[model samples]
Target: MLKNIFMLFISQGVNYLVPLILVPYLVRTLGAESYGEFNLALSIILYGCLFIDFGFNLYTTGEISKTENKEKIRHLYTVTIASKFLIFFPVALIIIFTVNNVSQFDNIKSVCYILIIQMLSSVISTVWLYQGLEKIRIYSLVNVVVKLLMLPMIFTLVRDTNDINILATIQSVSFLLSALLLITIAKRYDIYLVKINFSDIRSILSSASHIFTGTISVSLYTMSTPIILGLVNTAFEVGQFSATDKIRGAFISIFLILSNVIYPRINKLKVDNEFLAFRFIKKITMIQFFLGLTFATAIYYSAPYIVINYLGSEFQESIDLLRLMSPMVILVPLSVILSNYVLLTWNYKKYYLCVPLITCIFHFSYIIPLSHYYGAIGSGIGILITEFISFSLLLIFSLKSGMLRKIYES
Candidate 1:
């Protein structure tokens, strides 16, 4: 477990570091408006990604961890990929049609099309498989290498706003490269493609429906931020929000390292010994909360310094936005623990799904109005409120369902 965590840390370190270097340059070169345009396109494409993924990351990881049969694992692998592509075609068409027709997307229609390559790469990604198998060292290595490779290309090729296509192309190609490498390496784990019938795909999707809905509900506020802001606000504001969100996202990614590493372990423990799994959750929850508070406090206090040094004067708005979003660093970890570790692992998936559903209901009610009135800062408040509601709902649901009570009584 320590080894897996360390490897993921290194991988996430590169993931975070590359963006640390790349984003500043892109923002400086493209200017906030074009940079906002680029992120807006990427954000739209991520919806297609969510459709293609359809909660397979969490569902497959849990499924694969529980089973030992190579044939079953391979079957799951083939069906999952096949289902993604099945969903991909229609989603791709819809996204293309929407971007072309939508007034807001008029400026970034081409960039949106170019970023479809990244979506295709997301379809074939094998990180979930590697994580489930608890053999992610090579997977992490591939990510590190690909990110490093992207740095030089981006610096050399992306020099101006008109080069937005170049930036999208570079990101897409890098994603493809990483996906192909992971596919090759994952073959050793018995992850080869097999003949999957319609029934297989249907069954997998049916089983994953709740998981998929939960994923979408989570995305309602998370991924929809830039899109909503784009629709209601200006590009420059989206750029400012994007900057602070990037910094926030970097920290959240670091916090997720422990969650990812322990997910399969806890699933395995639940299978062998529920008591131990509960105990593990108890221990990790406290640890994760403390770690989250530390991160949130750090970001809150250092927001100005971080903004001044990393984002420059043009991005001064990001300081207050970053502070507004800092609390999410704490909330996200707690939410993950409650939903993934406590609820899902305990088989109270209804509550797990309900948490996000409930949050989304409240979020949509306020996010648009908030973004309409306050722009970046308004959206920041909406996000923080959303996270808090999610965490609170998860905690409440867990208690009402007696999951936490069981954790304590056991």
Candidate 2:
């Protein structure tokens, strides 16, 4: 398990690091205003992708966990690919049409088109199949290779200052390369194109319905920030917040790696030793508490230097936003891990419905008002408050239900 976790971490870490190194250049070249528009458009595409992905990734992983039958897994993979593609086409079309209708940002329409293509190709690749199969090593290697290949593109095409379309092109091509690599690698696992079966489709979709709800709710929390910011504030304001967020995202990557590492193990343990699962959750929660505090403090104190020195001085205003939002960086990992554990060990459907429903209410309620009054700063405060409430609720429920106690005892 540790080795698997390490491999996954290396993969995600490399992927995360590449963007961090490139972000400064990207920001400098694109300028904060353009970068803001670019990120806003990208955020919309990301949310669209989330909607396309629905719950298929998690649902597929759960399916693989239940049955080791190769043929069944293959069929499940095929159906998932088909389903996601079917969803992707319409979403991509909607995005394109929607972008065309928006007269405010002419340059952004092209960027959005590229993003839609990237998202479509990615869904077609069905990369999550490897996760479901527990092939962390292969998955990690594929990621590393893709990042390495993208280096030249970052260095040459995306120079200090370039057209936003060029940057968008690079982003799209990188995604295409990763998707192609996954497709080639997938063949080794015997996941090939096959005629879809209606019964299998029904089963996959039925299981995915719960997962879909959970994912959308989760997506609402994670993806709505940029959307909300864009809606309430200027594109330049969105850019500042997005740039700071890109940095904060790197910090959050550590927790994300940890959560991914433990989720499968928790699922496995829940079948026979619920106590072990509970203990694992407790241990992770405590670690997250301290780690969140440490990183939040470090980022808060260092934001000015980091933003001005590294990403350029134009983004100096982003420092305050970074500090205000840094604490949620910590809460996010704990919340994600706890939520996944709850979904896996308890009533997943109910868990999905409750958490996101609460989160959507608080997040929108706080963010909308705060953004209207104070712009980005208010938005940060709103996020911090929403996360605090949501995390507190999850922690309380975990304890009351004996989940945390069982985890600690184990």
Instruction: Report the number of the highest-lDDT candidate.
Output: 1
Q: In model 2, which residue pairs have backbone atoms overlapping below 3 Å? A: 278-407, 279-407, 279-408
Model 1: runs farther than 4 Å from truth? none
lDDT of 2 at 374: 79
Summarize candidate 1's per-residue lDDT along 210-266 as a digit string, tens digits.
888888999988999999999999999999999889999998888787677799999
Pick out the ten consecutive residues of candidate 1 with the lowest summed lDDT. 187-196
lDDT of 2 at 108: 79
Q: Runs in model 2 with CA error above 4 Å?
A: 159-162
